[model samples]
Target: MQPGLKLSQKVFFLVAVPLTVQLTFVAMLGHLLDQAEKEREREGRARQIIHHVNQIHRIIIGYIAGVAGEGLIGGGSKLEQSYSLRAGFDRELPPLQALLADNPKEFAHLLRLQKKAEASAEKLKQVKRMFKHGGDLALAGELPTMKLILRDLISELEAILSEERLIERTSPKIQATQRQRVRELLLTGVILNIIISIVLVFYFNKSFTNRLAIMMDNSIRLGLGQRLNPPLSGNDELSHLDSRFRDMTGALDAAARKERAVVENAADVIFSLDDSANFTKVSPAALKMWGYDPAFLVGKHCLAIVPKVDAKKTMEALNKVKSDDANNTFESRVVRKHGEIIDIVWSVHWSEPDNLFFCVAHDITERKIAEQVIKEAEARVRQILESLPIGLMMVTLDGKIVLANKTFEEVFGFNLADIEGETIDSILVDNRS
Candidate 1:
């Protein structure tokens, strides 16, 4: 119930709980985004690795196939052009070695594929040597058997390249699984955020607004001269206010007794009215001001005391005060008990809960004369400002003009109406300024 305790509860639920949930959600979302990005990059690398491996494999197969086809169909011109064949194999080996170094489990399979191509290269070298040393016709006789061996070796290499393609194809499914995990993490974060937000709103409402409502209700009861119990909730600021309200009720009782004793002894009349503009009570001061006795005013409507010419306006003003948040004060002609007219300033307070309000008044003929003098002075000042010859301008500290008189329009070529809300820089042709 202490003020500190109330603040601590607000901080715990509205600040601490929400901040913890937000940090946890942000951490989860950031981790998911990082993981998704990593998977995409890795998948791209995997495809690149496979593409390079396939390119080397293609060149190796094509070189060997070209040599075999040439020996079968023509002379060895195609085989000679493929010095590139040896260079391509040499270039591809180190990368393949590095790939296998990274993936030691894949080494044996890669090495098996490498060895198949190596065997075919050795066979082609032998066939090439035969053409160089043995006569062409004798080499031609040996070509049929060598050509068959070359065809079978090429088939084996193709089978190994096919296995590499299969491995590359699994990348998309791996990426998909990673994406689903990220989505789940994001959903969990959002759910946690919503739960924390609800708790924070509830804590704030209980800590501040609900407690203030309780305090205001107790104060209103005291205002109407009624007894109020101690607050049922926290002994914070609102509870202190409730204790003060109880003290005020006691004070009102003592004051009411003193006031009634004075009224009963007076030779004058004093009165109070309800919102329906009827008298609820009368004091001795009324007799001094209006020649009215307490007995004559009791249970009488207030319009009975007002001159008939001003009665409608006084009633309309009272109704306006009942509906508005502001209090109303006005002067009206009042009729004495014997019908003599007098002027008075009326003060009224409306209480919607109690269903009727109170009104009191005092003679205000001198104050009205003074107010009329002030009004005439204000009219003269307004006329002087309107008659000024020079253009008048009012600008804010930021150099934006808020008001400009008539002569300013001729100088600037714009009416105040056209440019009142616009910034100074907007009027320039080169707006960068």
Candidate 2:
């Protein structure tokens, strides 16, 4: 809407766009880092498996050589050789198989290797049982079978070890390539954001900021009573605004001239009073009517102008206006500058924006005197009606008494003030049901 405000919004979008991109990149990088770490852990486990299998193969070879060498020596115990083979197999196989279960690509191969090892260990256990039997017949049947199975186990373990080595060699390079691809995607997104930001900044400066600045300048010139010299060549909102401001300025000038004429020449004493009941302005007519200069009455309390006898009534009228009623008008008497009391017809209404009572009043001394004469004549008629010789009552076309004399008031036990304007049904005919 405004030039400076548009610039601020552009700056905010610029900052916020880049910050969001950076956050997204950071989240992606964290995910890639997590994947890399998982691959490294798998590689480490593969290496450990290879190392343990190799150790198991070396122990098997040593056991076979020891059994053959000790048979030639005629001194080694069969129990000692059997215990060495079984203890080494138990220490290595089960837990390694459990760890390998997580790697689906390698699990089938590892499981095959595990079954071969278990078969060899089972043959070694049978050979140990024959040795415990302690006869040449028991040894002859189991030792040859155990040696062949152990050799097969050694070959399977070497094959699995070679596969683990291949995985270890390739994993790091794959991780590095994945990281590079992620960085490239992130870089492309950042470049797109920068280009869009440049376009947005251009639009903000050219379309919004410049146009809004021109509007404000035109408005300020109009406010200072200067002609609008807008460069209007296009069917744009700014052109429409410039045209509207020109129209408004012309209307204001005409209204000011009209008000000046009225203030200078009006017959009524038009004035305004602040909320505290003090006068702020008075028309020229006020000076002529009161025989006091208008300046002498300005800035005086409105109550001070009224006679003491009517001061409370004037106050009541002012209070009624502040209570949110419609336009209020009251007639009151005021002592003029010449020390003579005058009757004025006064009207006052509240204006919220100025926090004041706008009032207009004019002298009505002749009309007030005429109305007093009329009231006296009506009172004389009432006196004549009260002193009637017969039961005379005046009723409207409807069967209701409108005017009642003294005899009527006595008959009804109600005064004229009580039932004078009331409907016939409201006042009982004879105080009966």
Candidate 3:
């Protein structure tokens, strides 16, 4: 295995290993089958040779019997039968020779046997001509000599049969040896294939799972704010995945830092509450707004800092932001640690996964106080204006009335509410219509 091997290549190697072994096994099995076929063919050829040898041997023995059986049969029938036996011997000879032709030694022996048969033929012709012309008594001198020649030929053929039968006898043992070889080859092939597969699987599994474990450990370290492991030394998919994970972690860390800086430098109070509505985090502005240590506010219930009069409204605001991405904007009075109450306009957002409510509180106490003073001044002006106004009304640049005195209202039969947003053009058009 190369150090820089890719994942797909490793996977291919894992599959290819066993496949290669199986292919090799199949190739070897094919060779064995070929050998078995050849052996079977050789055995069949031997059996054919044995059959032809037996037929020839039987005809040669009959030849000897017919020649010596003159007293036991009529002369004419005996001569006819002798000729027929001679023809049978001639017919069987060529086929036996052909069968033995594959073996040089056997073919040479058969050639010699054919030559000896030819020599006996001349001797038989001479005796047959004597017996035919002069009858049974004429063959008395030649019978013993002719029988000797035929007997010698029979002796040689029997020797050949003995050798052939010996060969035939060993066929079963040879077949058994072939069978054993086949069984051994099949068993060896199976065992080798299994071993190859198991070894490769274990090796690939070890390497792959080890790398996966390292990647998993890196993820845990990242989550716990610990340093990550060094990048893996490969171009495999797992290594690529680990690199991407590191990149994502770097991006997330940058984003978190930016958010932290924003929260720290912000002038308004920023805080978070846990699922139990307990204060879990408070920004640095807590000291300026709440007049308390941010650490001191941790684990404190939100209602502790909320005035009783505004507690219900604050609870309602919290409920409004219950689901993820939901937000609520409202104003509530918060009690400072110094026991003073102040108005705060809150913008709250919910994050269900974190089970926290993120809130920004802007103190609106000064704005509310200024609003009260403006309303009081407007009331005093209205009193003075009502005392001396004679159909006097205040209008905006668009000729829409903004304010009207009682005198103006009585004369026009219109209050400021009726004409406050109406353009001069629309009002005149309405009056004409």
Candidate 4:
């Protein structure tokens, strides 16, 4: 995975894994909130049922006690108690019916309680009818049965209340269990996320550090001019960078080899001198030019081979090359290994990076000897031409008087320097007839 993935992709995966885990936990928390809302609604319904049953029980007790007003029996005007009791049952029945619709089996006991309440209400109505038609004695006779029915209704209503109370008591424990389960799930998810994050961080850090270390080692080797091995294999960015670095190093090495080839096979004596004018490198051509092995000349001063007469001039030229940052050409005589003197023309320049002077020396001894011979021949011809009885002058094919003897200068009233560049036609005697 490390080898195949890019750095950005790996970072995204690491970040997304933890975020995804947290999002899952957030979803679970939302579910927990929904469950809590449901629990609240169920609790409200249970409380409503308990309140309705309590009201029913109070109305039965008051009816038996012959009280009136609210749930009381005989406190209100004559028909008000009966009317109030009936109105109370009428108002409470709808909620009970709604509860029955939601959980028919759970509120089955309330159905029996409602039947008893209705029967007691009918019995009370019968006693009122007997009192109106059959007088006080008939009312007194129905009172015992009315009491018995009231007792049964009260018992049924109490039973419903007890059931509701039990449910209310157990609901909190159930909700607590659900909350604990959710908390455990959240804790487990958080722990798992942390563990995964740690593992991934360690894995990636180790992988990146190791690969970077290899690249750094390779860079150090390159700086020291040492050979390098192939870089580690991968398709990632670091791998590509390493590949480019290797190519650059290979190109530099090839260029160095080509330059060495040029210097080794050159005809002139190619060499480099240190800042102190000591020979640091000498090419193989030194053997043919200086009659000394290149190996023997390394570390020697540049003035070591220079004749005493030419040493000052060579040093001055070397200083000018360094100070001016330019190439310089000069001729000097050098003493060879077998004590033979050779004239050589040297071209030298300062190399700032190497803190050295690079020089290419060409042996010019044969050319110098040829030039000296020509100078002597010209002097002898001038002497001979001057000593002759007849004046003589030398001219070029282009009609330029290049040389005129002292006798010709006297005859023409002009020195050789005056007529040197004058055309021959301008200086010749007019002999045409």
> Any runs in candidate 3 off by more than 4 Å, and if so which?
71-83, 90-98, 129-148, 151-166, 274-276, 291-300, 323-326, 351-356, 369-433
Candidate 1 residues 1-433, lDDT tens each? 2344645565555677778878877887787778767766656655655665666656765665565555555565666466456677687767766655655445555676578667767877777666556566646676685667655655644554455556557657766877887788788778878876776676667767776776677678667756564554665555566667667767877898897787766543445566666787887777778777767788888887788889889888888888894567877977776766767887777877766656667687567678888999978865665567876666677767676667666666778888786666655487587
Model 2, range 1-433, lDDT digits (tens) per residue?
2333434565676677767877887887778778878888878887888877777776677666555444434334463465366677677777667767776655666567667766665665556555656556666665678667776776677677777888788877877876786788678767877786787677666755676687787778868867666554344455566567668777988997799689869888888999888989888888887776778888999888799899999988988997864588889988888789999988888988788888899889988889999999999998999898655567687756688888877776778777776777776457576
Q: Cα RMSD (Å) per model? A: 28.1, 14.4, 5.6, 4.7
Where model 2 places Cα greater than 4 Å from the true spot, the runs are 1-23, 71-83, 104-114, 122-148, 182-193, 220-433
Q: In model 4, how many backbone clashes occur?
A: 7
TM-score of every prediction relative to native: 0.48, 0.43, 0.76, 0.76
Give the 10-residue window scoring lowest on summed lDDT in candidate 3.
Answer: 68-77
Pairs in clash, predicted candidate 1: 268-284, 269-284, 269-285, 269-286, 269-287, 270-282, 270-283, 270-284, 270-286, 271-282
* Better candidate by lDDT, 1 or 3: 3
Residue lDDT tens for model 4, 131-240: 55655566567667766887788777767777678778988987887788788888888788889888877867765767888889899999999877668677778888
> On a 0 to 100 scale, what is the lDDT of residue 218 in model 2?
72
